[model samples]
Target: MSEKVIAIILAGGKSSRMGQDKAMLRVDGAHLLLRVYQVAVACADNVYVVTPWQERYEDLLPVGCQFIREARYEGDDVKQVETHGPLIGFAQALAEVNVDPEWVLLLACDLPNLEVEVLQGWIEGLENSRAEAIAVLAKHEKGWEPLCGFYRKSCLLGLNKYISEGGRSFQQWLDQNTVDILPDCSTDMFFNCNTPEDLRRRLL
Candidate 1:
């Protein structure tokens, strides 16, 4: 069976280290989010970006691309501010979006060099794999590449359950379920911009 995927781009994080929104950061004349979106469009038919502030990126998004306004969780601090994390935002978007597919292609918009070919290669591997796994994620020498991975829609319930029960650790959450880790994933495709040094390094 041909595996279908709904590409979900995660762009809702607070870029505290980067000193700027990584989504809007320019790369070779185009915004980072737009660059990722352009690559995502080539890999899947239905693609969406999930962000905390939609207006901040409304003009920067590529044409035909849509985003979900990330629902915030009340933080434990005295100020009672809202927090935007990958799990919460992912759950919210999956609940609100109408598109249905065999797998959810999760991506981080900060990856300036993420290629359409690499994304498609992962999908092909998933389709060809005989193992019955809930998700297919890439693992580097350091650890698993959680953001740039594929998750089966069936895992949504377990994921939300873990989050609701005070579980925020991504690796711990994955430990509770079956996941296929793709080895030898391209390092360049997963090179994400987290700090100013990453952008300044010209790694791309």
Candidate 2:
């Protein structure tokens, strides 16, 4: 059998830009986190939510969705090294899974248009390209979007090392890996909700 694909939802951000937890934001009738969780469930064998506060995510996450807390900013060597950022979250997740998955589809909770079909397309694209991973490529003006991408769990060690060195930029870590970009066409699947206007146009 092939290695199973896992889905990791990054929900630990301070949500400073949105003024509230983006995962708590509603699009259609479901919370954004739950929506993304549903999509992840559709595409992978397992799903996990990466957050610092399990209580904050209680209402936003569905029953049975596993939660992995990033290592706190202040703690022992293990803790300090694990709280850098998204990489920290991924590291904690890998510890829980105990095996290298074929891929771990990482997604942000702020995008309202991340649906099952789109994610399925991403998985297929990754397989077809024979690339190490597949990420949605934002336009020139938009820059690169890695929040919505697929990664191999075997890379967790290198990612953890980057975090230990105080690297917080996800794009920078991705640069050292084989990443294939899935260009955004007419529709922007990664149109994240950052401002009131963006939320209004996409969520409300």
Candidate 3:
């Protein structure tokens, strides 16, 4: 089967530690989510932004950019929509993608340093990946960098099974699968704005 690529940018976080919406934060005169979406557009055939607030970002993106409403679960009798973190959010979006032999470029919305050329280079290597490999991701000292990487479309079944079994941690789920480590990547490329301090560091 021929390979097809698509991107999914997760933006449903509450930004509790950042004290503001990181996706809407401005960097170099561009919103964080818009910047990431542009980068994804450069390297992938299609780009999708997964967030709870679609109207907030709809005007920011250009034409052809799609939005996938982040899944929320009802909490208590009040039926408040509650986020279950990136893992669940990712699974919900992945289920909507209907491509065969697909390679999904998954990213967090706060990664402002992402470079289109670097991501394009990574996409070029997907064809060389092993048959058993389910994902191709950069590895840090702690573990695989799950957010900024690529996963096979075939992995949806395994991912859903893991989530149904109460597995939420990306690192935990990755450790149980065979993943190809991304080569020749700089740690700075994965730098994300999670807190005010991180935002300051990015600007400097």
For each of the candidates, the C-alpha root-mean-square deviation to the true structure, in angstroms, is 2.8, 4.3, 2.3
What are the Cα lDDT values of the candidates?
A: 0.80, 0.72, 0.88
Best by lDDT: 3
| lDDT tens per residue, model 2, 1-204 | 333578888887766678777788888988888888888899888888878777888866667778887656655664342334666676677667754566878888787887677677667665554455534343344555767777776777787787788887777877766666664444577778887778888744
Q: What is the TM-score of each candidate against the true structure?
A: 0.89, 0.81, 0.93
Between 1 and 3, whose TM-score is larger? 3
What does candidate 1's lDDT look like per residue over 153-173, in tens digits? 777788889988998877788
Task: Show model 2 residue runs off by greater than 4 Å.
Answer: 1-4, 74-83, 129-142, 183-186
Candidate 1 local lDDT, residue 62: 56
Model 3 C-alpha RMSD vs. true structure (Å) is 2.3
Residue 198's lDDT in candidate 1: 93
Candidate 1 lDDT trough over 10 residues, lowest sum? 74-83
lDDT string for model 3 (1-204, tens) is 335689999998888899888999999999998899989888888888988778888788887678888756666864355778999989999998775547999999999899887788888888999989999999978788899999998899999999999999999999999999998866588998999999998898
